[model samples]
Target: MKTLMKRLRAFALSGIIGVGLLGSFPALAAKTTLTVGAAATDVGTLDPHYATSTSDRTLVAWIYGALVRFAPGSTDPSTIEPDLAESWQVSNDKLIWTFKLRTGVQWQAGYGEVTADDVVYSLEKSRDPKRSAFSADFAAINKVEALGPHTVRITLSRRVPNLLGLVTNYAGGFIICKKAYEERKDRFGRAPVGFGPFQTQSIVAGQAVTLIANDKYFRGVPKIKTINYRFMSNNAARDLAFAAGELDASAGLANKSWLQRTTSIPGAVVDVFYPAELTLLHINITKPPFNDIRVREALAYAISTQKIAEYRGERFTRAPKSVIPSNNLGYTDNAGVFPYDPAKAKALLAQAGYAKGLTFTMLSSQLPEYETTAQLLQGQLEESGINVQLQPVEHTSWHQMIRKDLSPVVIYGAARFPVADIFLTQFYHSSSIVGTPGAVTNFSHCNVADKQIDEARTEADPAKQVALWQEAQRLIIQNVCAIPLTETSQVWVHNKKLNWGFDLKGSMSLGPLVTEQTSFSD
Candidate 1:
């Protein structure tokens, strides 16, 4: 009886141990996922053609590819190399372009092989104003035609400043699988199909966007099997999540204090990138007293851009010397702008018939950068007896509201292809005036530089094109259409264990990219 009892206990112990081992097996088989914390409430869209917001742009870069692309870990236009297309050609006059597609590139979710037909379809969508936000950029394209299953050709209506920039993998240049998009229609943005390293798995609204590796990816399977992109709008919470090991990477605050605090985190690596985004305070010229040039000049004179730039920290930000960003092809530092004179600003305001002071309400984004800048602007404007009542709103909502012309003063920060024509056309051209047909982000409704901007677009001579752009900047600055504030570079932080495949550098998408070779070190 004693022997039998011992045998029974041994059998039970063995069964319990077996069950525990089974539980550990599943843990060992778990996927290697890189969890990321993005600084946004939610993604605006995943459709590459319309993905303007930073979070959306980041995801688009992972899910889609263009004919040519900026090399991984690079933002320089010169670093552009073949992506979907193996090779390409251009006509002597640069009016026609041809691309030869790579064979056997499989689309995600068994959407089948990518072909010239798909390229034709994608470029057409990019050219359509109703279908793409970047239609203005593709205006020079007369036709996109598929010569065969593996060949595509483009015909340009006029010579463009940068034809490669338009076709490269940024903004509307991202290719979409034709069959999948036609089947999904409007649901395509949510359920995307592309031939990139990762395939979209799921998106939990306001929570996370999960992507899994494409085993059949032409570039080779992504070593990191999955990506869990989470939206954490609150900066402090996002940083804490990273500190607690819940997030492998997170978008970082641009200011110095946050940088210092984050650097103190054990094993944390901070990346400060180049091609700073120029911030412009756009005064709506069509609205109220702002229609008067004196009022706009007064506002410009009242706020010292030097002080505003320094407030964000000298390392992260720099005062703009021209309407065009510092590094652009046609940037001119000699564009005359008003001096910081509070007394002069008051005189201008009084001349514009607001001697007691002018009060106006401006909608401000809750995003830390915009809100802090708005507060700083409010205090500075008050010194010249100009009152600006700020009404804070969510960042996404602020983007929508400002587009609807709800805000008289729109503080916008953006970086485009390193060119003067792009910045001038989108922000100062009469064609891109806000609230009009074919309008873009022209919050000021500025049309003063129409001639210079229009001429610069097709200026055949390089020097003449640059000259036209410089003159446009001078005209816009003199008209006081917008106050060029500062340029703020992108900042992000990641775990030291994380290897982003390429060296840390500038990214056009304004974030670090996780490529096929990306992995975490033990």
Candidate 2:
């Protein structure tokens, strides 16, 4: 009781003192340093063209500005605004997109003006499959031709209704400086240059990335002077650091217990947001037992999404209706495929020639969230006579094994929203088979949802197009390619005095971290 009062008094006194000194010692009264602790050791790449991992995206946002950007710190796709391109127009047929670039956008590190050539070159590189993991995003563009120094035209083979959404920083929307790239080549990945509100002061691979505010930022310069992003992979350690004031913010964990405990700290503020993340389990259809549709349906019936969401903590979790999460564009409620009915599960199992029930090994990551959820699922499956042997493996090795088609079941958690076609094609199209043709993330190795996906992409009318996407989602659910367990919320704990520049709606990248608009109140 005394400790709490003491801490509370200290905050009050600090605020009072800060306010009193502001007029006389304004510079000394302002707080300048902002530190963000992330739960990652390394980024996949620093090059904006190929940086796709969470860590990479978070840091890259500081350096790059996409042609179009999602409204800062917002998950709402409707709030997209112009970046390098001041305006854009699409042809009546929607196959051609013309952009009017903004004038006088300066590049970092002595690079010259950002021009049509740079925009076209950056997008073309993003379109090359060999160079970019996100090439699939830019694959629809037939050609990117520069009309002039300040104008660019893009020709698409067919209509892309969601192409505008894909250009955001989270997607393949970041523009690059061609001159800087040709001069640096592969070295550009380590030392990137861009025109954003902040620029990299220094970066040490796998350790920390330091950024200084861009004084000449097109948008106003950030009130905070420096942002130090530290890599702390351990959840407990990261949380402890935030609680002790070593960190101003953290990557925000999914676990609820941590949130409950951390929010109790004096002057700490915790915000939870549904950041388009879905926790799902993938059933390999090519595997012997799952090859039978009845077996897949039986397994689905056996696992209870309600129970799974409950086990994951209902406060931060919601039961997912299908493989396509509710946050995505084509979301529809066809939740009837696998309602929790053990009797129906057993009957289907018997019909599939497994009268005594079936047993399979499910490979899960060694991370606490994955391991604990797997164990909880194991208990839930027993209720339906579906025996599952949960094997915990290293996170990296687990992903490799699942992609290799080794596990009978693989648990995956990802979110592709606003542009639902990504989930539809990458996880459902047969050509997207992980180790095959496209070398995509499609571990299901099935193509039942391809037709609907293709139709949705080219559909001219927005309403009818949505129906096509809904049909594709229904197909994935009915076919039992994967089982969605829950929509997990990511949580961020921060100091109360830290003004994050924007209200916490949700972030597609960094969860409630400081931005150019962010500053300290005291």
* The candidate that achieves the highest TM-score relative to the unseen native structure: 1
Report model 1's TM-score to 2 decimal places. Answer: 0.93
Error of 1 at 52 (Å): 1.2
Show where candidate 1 strays beyond 4 Å.
1-31
Q: Give a tens-digit lDDT track for model 1, residues 17-113.
A: 9998896664453237899999888877888988877778888888888899999988787899999999999999999999999999999999889
Worst 10 residues of 1 by lDDT: 23-32
Error of 2 at 68 (Å): 0.7
Error of 2 at 488 (Å): 2.0
The C-alpha lDDT values of all candidates are 0.88, 0.77
lDDT of 1: 0.88
Give the distance in Å from residue 230's predicted Cα in candidate 2 to where it truly belongs. Answer: 2.0
